[model samples]
Target: MIYFVNILPQSNGDHVIHTENCAHLPNMRQRTILGYFKTSMEAIEVAKKNYAKCNGCRDCSEAIYNNYN
Candidate 1:
């Protein structure tokens, strides 16, 4: 899947990682392309390279979000 990371941080200070087609995905100007990956884990790991706190999208990557929580 093609993933993206929100440039804007959430109130909890997490930059959410999302699948390309996620309903909750941030607008283009507010997100950065995170490359293609088979799993959300790969996308989250990539986001973590720059952001200190990253979480998978609740709507698209529920499994990853659950693991992080």
Candidate 2:
């Protein structure tokens, strides 16, 4: 299953709302956010914005993997 893990923060909280089945992948279960956006373009934008502020390599990899895979 493909998961759209939102790495961007929302106005309501610091969490990234994710899409369904985002956690289905064994490696992605621990991911913070996975949300289904209206379009892939939007998802990519959010991912890029979030990746830029990542503090760890794992986070950067995870976000990239989630967006591409």
Candidate 3:
């Protein structure tokens, strides 16, 4: 699946990663494409290289969000 990371930081300073189909996925102007990934973890790992405090969107990447959020 395709994934993306929000360009804006969360209130707690995390940059949220979301699946393309996520309910809360940000608009193109507000996010950075993370590329096609087999799993949310893969996208999250890529997001982490650029954003130290990256977490997954709870609605679409629940397993990832649960681990970090």
Candidate 4:
């Protein structure tokens, strides 16, 4: 029932991706994605997109939950 906001880089560091809501998720818990971005915006975009995709995925919530755990 929580969310986290994360900034991850794309493999080439060209964009930054965001995650749930950082306030909800902690450092010890987070899904692992390979990305390298030059700025945080790009990462946020990716995370947002993933979140949208995860909305329909039953396993996605669990994945995020596990990472946050």
Candidate 5:
């Protein structure tokens, strides 16, 4: 499967990384592409370096957790 992720800049100087299809994703015009990854864990790792996990994106968080564990 082709997986993708994105990074959304926050007003607070933080960024949120979410799965491409995450329901919590901000509108397309509001987000930046972080690039695609082979696995969700890869995307999560990259996201963790620059942004916090979005609390509203349970699917993203759960995917990362499940992939890592």
Candidate 6:
């Protein structure tokens, strides 16, 4: 399966990352594309390097937690 992540730039200059299917994702007009990966973990890894986790996305947060723990 393919995995994807989005990088959202905040007004304060911080960034947030969300899974492609994240329910909290911004509207299409406000969304930004980071890139796609072969695995969720891969996408998460890249996101971790540049952005903070989005607490609004439970699936994305759980995936990261499960993968690391």
Best by lDDT: 1
Estimate every model's Cα lDDT from 0 to 1.
0.90, 0.40, 0.88, 0.35, 0.54, 0.52
Look at candidate 5 and give me any clashing residue pairs.
none
Clashing pairs in 3: none
**Deviating ranges (above 4 Å) for candidate 6:** 1-16, 28-31, 52-56, 65-69
Ten-residue stretch with the least lDDT total in model 3: 60-69
TM-score of every model versus the real structure: 0.93, 0.33, 0.91, 0.32, 0.48, 0.44
Model 2 is weakest, by summed lDDT over 10 consecutive residues, at: 53-62
Q: What lDDT does candidate 5 reach at residue 37? A: 75
Q: What TM-score does candidate 4 get on C-alpha atoms?
A: 0.32
Q: In candidate 6, where is summed lDDT lowest over 10 consecutive residues?
A: 52-61
Measured over all alpha carbons after superposition, the RMSD of each candidate to the real structure, in angstroms, is: 1.2, 8.8, 1.2, 11.7, 4.9, 4.8
Model 5 residue 50 CA deviation (Å) reads: 2.0
Model 1 alpha-carbon drift over 4 Å, by segment? none
Query: Residue 56's C-alpha lDDT in candidate 5?
Result: 20
| Cα displacement (Å) at residue 54, model 5 | 6.4
Worst 10 residues of 5 by lDDT: 1-10
Question: What value of lDDT does candidate 6 attain over all alpha carbons?
Answer: 0.52
Candidate 6 shows a clash count of: 0
The residue ranges of model 2 lying beyond 4 angstroms of the native Cα positions read 1-3, 6-19, 22-29, 34-36, 52-69
Superposition TM-score, candidate 3 onto the true structure: 0.91
Q: If ranked by lDDT, best first, what sequence of candidates would result?
A: 1, 3, 5, 6, 2, 4
Ranking by TM-score: 1, 3, 5, 6, 2, 4
Supply candidate 6's per-residue lDDT for 52.
Answer: 57
Model 4 alpha-carbon drift over 4 Å, by segment: 1-29, 52-69
What does candidate 3's lDDT look like per residue over 1-69, in tens digits?
999999899898999999888889988899999999998888888998898898888898877995864
For residues 1-69, what per-residue lDDT tens digits would candidate 2 score against the true structure? 223444444353333334444333234544644345654445555655655422212332344333442
